[model samples]
Target chain A: MTPSREQKLWMYEKMLVSRRFEEAIETIYLEGKKPVFNMAKGPIPGEMHLSNGQEPCAVGVCAHLEPSDVVTATHRPHHQAIAKGIDLKRMAAEIFGKATGLSGGRGGHMHLFDPAVNFACSGIIAQGMGPAVGAALSRKMQGKPGVAIAYIGEGAVNQGAFHEALNLAAVWKLPVVFVVEDNAWGISVSKAASTAVPENHVRAEAYGMPGHLVRDNDPYEIFATAGKAIAAARNGEGPSLIEIETMRLAGHFMGDAETYRPKGEKDGLTLRDPISRMRARLIADGDADEATLDRIEEAAQAEVDEAIAFARNSPDPDPADALTSVFV
Target chain B: MTNTNPARANERKLTIARAMAEATAQQMRLDPTVFVMGEDIGEFGGIYGNTRGLIAEFGAERVRDTPISETAFIGAAVGAAQDGMRPIVELMFVDFFGVCFDAIYNLMAKNTYFAGGSFRVPMVLMTSTGGGYSDGGQHSQCVYGTFAHLPGMKVVAPSNAYDAKGLMTAAIRDDNPVVFMYHKGLQGMGWLGTVPGATNHVPEESYTVEIGKAAIARPGKDVTIVSLGIGVHQALEAAKRVAEHGIDAEVVDLRSLVPLDRETIRASVAKTGRLIVVDEDYHSYGVSGEVIASVVEHDLSVLKAAPVRIAYPDVPIPFARVMEQFCLPNADKIVAAIETMLGRQTVGEPS
Candidate 1:
């Protein structure tokens, strides 16, 4: 079915918003305006799975979800949170470890949480799948059409819980959608190097479910595929897996050396970038024009700037709070 | 026709297994949401036969059984609990918890608070612990002490038929996750080591005792013997022998380990001025060590002698029957430890 021009324009704007928001964070990191203990910044040596090249996956999948539908994402979650309409200021505060953060400054970037928007973040490799399955089970038991979305990277497909949760979800016919944003690499290891079949969707066969492959950089394609899977789940067809192929257009983090990736793999993917492709599609298809695309970009940048300003001014979390949420 | 009912009631004597079965049945009947899931816990009953007849009464749906994957089923229990189901997960042996500690500690115990207390996981994990039938190290270790140390977890180790029935009921109803340890050594012992006619009876009616409260089984003056689970019976027997030596010994059975009855211990130590902790698990950092630390930190003046513990050596339980016997504390060992603590050099062995 052909989507309405308004719906196409809305998807383009959402994708643009996520891409610009992540770019803002990257810039903030480069300027040393990030967390003092951010090991991913400067010369410190850990990877931050930035949502640089894969913004469309979140924007596209989440475009169909209502505020009541829940989502759980991996460490790379800025794009997902923005797509879910979580307050940008609260998300920025959380990433900055400020008292006004979504988790009251308890959870950092990877552990972001905004229950009011039904988003639970996880730093654990594939642990987010459990909570995703849980929320989906809750929705089924409550007789609600609340689809639970688990946004994971290609790397998470290797986790044991990932496999166990998927099988259990199918057996129980939980209303969940597992979106594997296969941006070609799991950390420094390429998907081909890690798995015998490099095709993540094939594992769905083991779980007795349907798996789809899509062009991850094309927001329209991702939206159409995800909509079908999510609608099937909400309609009591159990769970579905969608593995979308995209490229990483930025270093894993602001200061990542990109040693293992081919020299131009990061910059080369810029040609078919999800956000820009969506904008071009919207204009060429007569849904929107150059001026409308420019306005969307300007608005997203302004919102990101405002979020940074709010984060910079927010208060640090109380030292006493360190012991508070540990038990509750 | 009514006279037969009263005569039948007088003839019914409850076994530990029967009491446990009744408790689980009563709780499941009271709350339709309560379900039992584990390995061989259905048509075959539990390995110990404590859950016999439940599958027939509750049907296959509520009394579901699973394959031998402790991690998956335990994870399922955690998942089910999050979705408002009261799941009584049986982990065949307490030692098997190692396979799924993350599901217990990281997930079930911390999920609610981590979600900012927006969720409550009500789960009861039942497992057999302790040794006597020579199940060896992997199968027989008493590991409830490990769970008691965790913040969000509640640990209960009930000693007798009555406490077993009450505490099992309590665990199912608890808002938080509880690890209920039923000692393999204590069950099916009938009424051995009891005074001549002292009844070991549990009423047909079901009930639940509050968690974290300690029950005083036998009261005395010379020394307070703090014990839990299977150790409670050993302490009781030792107290009897101490009475034969003309020294009254207090026996305090700690039914719940986490909300440990610190006040009761403090009060008992205050009266006796001495403590002998007979713990079944290993000695290092065991429950006995914590009890002694709490007592020494608070009421040192009450301690007439250095607080001593009769605990197993810090080693994996050996498989040999003789070795297992030497490794675990018994009634005679508790009596000797008590005698030594009070400086009454030889109480159990006649001079």
Candidate 2:
């Protein structure tokens, strides 16, 4: 029911990597586009959807997941993809549009398809729902010891596909967990304008499923909630929806001006950053010292730097081969 | 085209990306109602440098970054335009039009017609197009034909910086919904790498290059080559190589596709009596087909020889660079096609 100190530390390490990797991406995604901002003028062109402040939801939920367990994520998929244990270097290369990338540079940022770890994501809204539901169904039919997690954003709750997937998972009692990373704002439109309900977890009641809400971007609460939900799903009880009040620290996309954000909201978020809070919590609880945490942070930085370097040095796929993988 | 004159300092060169942003900035300054909206148009400057630096001047309210809700924001631009505001909305990639087709095809394109000339929808839907650096099918597409084919929407695709600024100004001032598609390869973006000479000497002052007219990019006498966007650059390269062989190939950049610059095509084809239509879109039901049709419908006698089409094969764009390049229209392919057409070389034999 509770994580050991080593297990908590492991979660910290994963969380640290997610944050450091995204920070690297933020810097690299802006490579030559600055002083004269051009999105198409960077190593990572196209849309860059970052999940900077939403690390806890991924690390907490994925700590209990295995390589065999299926995980489907949304457009803002960096944190979850990293936590799901997909190849970090390959992911960076994928974002770089290189030959050595996970999808051979085919999918780019939003369409990272790493099937080795049963991890994949899509760019469209609520696109991962059916795949998550289907993956869980196949596992159940084969009597396999695995579950599927459909990770979506608060904005995706309004999409009809999300509701349909949730109902299907619940009615069929599939081993799937619907995780909503509720970051409050969706592009420029707020949750208040988009959704009818105040909270996303409450909507799970409509599908005859149990709902759990975790607040404050707290990993402790998120881990507790996700543990029980996954335990139940793995035990063949049913599906549960876990909504975490995550933070979207950056703009909707990398270049977003964020004028729609309330004044002082970004500053407030910076102060309440989940990483600093967790570092403080770990020290206060006697789980880890500042020196140890610093070492972990340093190790994470090294790993991220190596991954980025690999992506930067990797050769681009031959333009003639773009037609190859369409079939097999 | 480079203006080689010391006194013409105002004609300093600019990229399609800078020219487009400059035009939007100028229009926004003149007209209070002229605003911009898209996924990353604000501080992040648009995905293709189309709205760069506007947010710092006009502030976020005017140079807004709407949520990724394309269906809502694109339709909102139409609604705002109908209500007396000029909104320049960008749909990130032209390939993303499927998710929000109603707002674009129905409301933005046909709203004024449906209202029976009640009100005008003076809006600009600027988007990125082209396939060269392997962004896969979604990010890399020159589907301006689809926009041009949809009756009410005026399709404007500019190849150089001069026309990029001119047509953007015209699109802003026009009282009809205009779809401005700028190819990524001609944007002078350093990341994807661009064709040399894509930048041109664009004048500082705002000017409108008349819509429905084509510009003679290069002059020749033996054959006429018509193309736009990245294809125009490829055509120019092909023209220079053929000139060495004494086979003249005139290049006509059909800047606006919707207005269908038939007059220019007819005039050019009439002069040379040989035609070649080059397009980055699919081979079927595309600009190439329409250009060839315009020539044939006018007079069957205009053709001294059978016309040729250099275009992407009918298939979804591939993500692998090798496959994409094979599908793309390039200078070598154009040269080979010309060589075969002129009987100087045989088919399937490299010149």
Candidate 3:
């Protein structure tokens, strides 16, 4: 199904917002890298996995989801969290390790959980799949209308939990959509070197589920595929798989040399930048003018800037409070 | 004998397995959100029969028989719990935890704390533990100590049919993730021989035995015998054997390992002035050592004699019955340990 002009614009804006939010995180992370020698001594402490060029997957898939729908994301989850409508201010505070953070400064960047939007991320590979399956099972048992989306990286497909979860979800006919974001690399290891199959969605057939592959950074294609899969799941037609092929424009983590890639492989990365391509397409298709596109970028930047300000002003969690929150 | 109140005539005798099933059924009836999922739990009524007759009552939807995917089902239980469902997922055997340890220790145990108190994994991971029938190293292990060593999980190993029902009820109602471990030998299954009082009189109605409380099984004034699960029965037998020698042993059943009832243990040790921790788990850095340390850490003056431990030696449980019995903590071992601690003649060549 072709997206309407308004839908295209909304997708464009969301992609832009995700990109800008990640960009802000990168800048803030760099600021903390003052004495380049020691990376640990920083305001945004701990490793930060930025979803720089993978914004289209989040924007496209989340655009079809309601706030009630549950989403489980991977380590690099800023883009998906933003697209899923997790409060940016609290998320920023969480990354900054402030008391006003989503997890009260306990969970850093790797473990962001916004229960308001039913979103959670895990640092472990393929770990989110089980939880997403559980959430889907819960929705099905409760006769709820919500479906769960589990976002995993291509590298995670090789994990046992991934296959186990898919099989369980299929056997149970749970309302869950497994979205595999094929960014081509798991940290330094390329997908070709890691995964046995050339494509990820094809493996979904092993579990007796319909699988679709969306090539390139096309948000429209993702939206179309995700919409159908999500609808099928919500209607109790069981789970489906959608694999979106994308690129990682940035290093695996902040300050990652990315020496594993060939020289100049990242030089032309911007050529396939999803945000830029969507912006250009929106303007060319007459869905949005250049001025409106520019306005969206500015608004996204403003929102990110406000989130940063809120995080900076937030208080650090007291040392004594560490004993709290261990239980209910 | 301590109290004059008459026992309720309605109290029915139940095996640990039946009591557990009744507790689960009662909880599932009380709360629509509560459900059971495990391997062969639906039509087969669980390998240990802890979930017998649940599928017939709750239907296949609630009493689900999951595929042999511990990581997936356990992780899914965590996810379901986070989404406001109280799931009771079984691991089939605690020994199989090695395959899905990450899901239990990492996500289920630490998620609530990691989420900064915003999320609660109100799930119960009920797994069968212990081995007396030569299940071997792979199938037999009371790994409650390993689970209790972790920070975020509440560990409960009920000794009798009564505590099994109460503890299972409490575990289901609890907001935190609970590891409800039931010994296969204590389930009172006809196929698997039960201990002396494994099939005790349990109340018909639903109730919760407080999670972090210890029950004095056989109160006395001499050495305090601290144990749990199958070890409780062994300790009681040892106490009776030693009572002929005028040794008044107080058997303390530590129902919950995490949030441990250290207060009761300390009080018992303070009164008895001697302690002997009998554990089926390994000897080094385990429950027995923890119990000894609790008394030492709190008040060293309470001990008139050095505390002792009767536990499995630091070795894998062998498959041979003779070897397994030698490695296992039994009444003979407990009695020997007590006799040795009291400077008396050791029995049965110091097992």
The most accurate candidate by TM-score is: 3
Give a tens-digit lDDT track for model 2, residues B1-351: 222212244568888899999999999889987888779999989878889999999997788776566765665566456545788989888899888776688557654543324446788999888888889998888887788887778888988888899999999998888899889889987786877667888888988887777888888888899999989988988888877777889999999997888988998999999898899998998889999999999987978899999998999999998999999998888888888778795224224
If the candidates were sorted by their lDDT against the true structure, best first, what order would they fall in? Answer: 3, 2, 1
lDDT tens readout by residue for model 1, A6-124: 76777766677777777666666555425454564531124455787787787778888998898888788888888888888988877777777776666667766666777766676
Off by over 4 Å in 2: A1-328, B1-11, B345-351
The CAPRI-style docking tier of model 3 reads high
For model 1, the DockQ equals 0.29
Docking class of 2: incorrect
Cα distance off (Å), candidate 1, residue B43:
2.6
* DockQ of each two-chain model: 0.29, 0.01, 0.86
- After TM-score superposition, what is the CA distance of residue B162 in candidate 3 from its true location, in Å? 0.4
For residues A1-328, could you state the per-residue lDDT of candidate 2 as single tens digits? 6677887898898888989999999998899897988899978898899898899999889989999898878889999999999899999998999988877776788867665687767666776675576566556644778888989999999885677677767766879899999999989999998899999999899999999999999987888899999999999998999999989999999899999999999999999898888899999999999899999999999999999999999999898766444211
**Alpha-carbon shift of residue A128 in model 2 (angstroms):** 28
Candidate 3 C-alpha lDDT tens digits along A1-328? 7778887888877777778778777777877577673568678878889888899899899988999999999999999999999999999999999999999998889899998999999999999999999999999999888999999999899999999999999999999999999999999999999988999989999999999999996999999999899989988899999999999998898888899998887977878788878877887788888888889888988988899999999999997888998789
Per-prediction TM-score, chain B alone: 0.92, 0.95, 0.95
Query: Candidate 3, which segments miss by more than 4 Å at Cα?
Result: B1-11, B346-351
Which pairs in model 3 have colliding backbones?
Answer: none
- Residue A271: error of model 1 in Å? 3.5
Give the alpha carbon lDDT tens digit for every residue of B199-298 in model 3.
8788888988889898888889989999999999899888888888878999899989988999999999999999999898888989999999999999
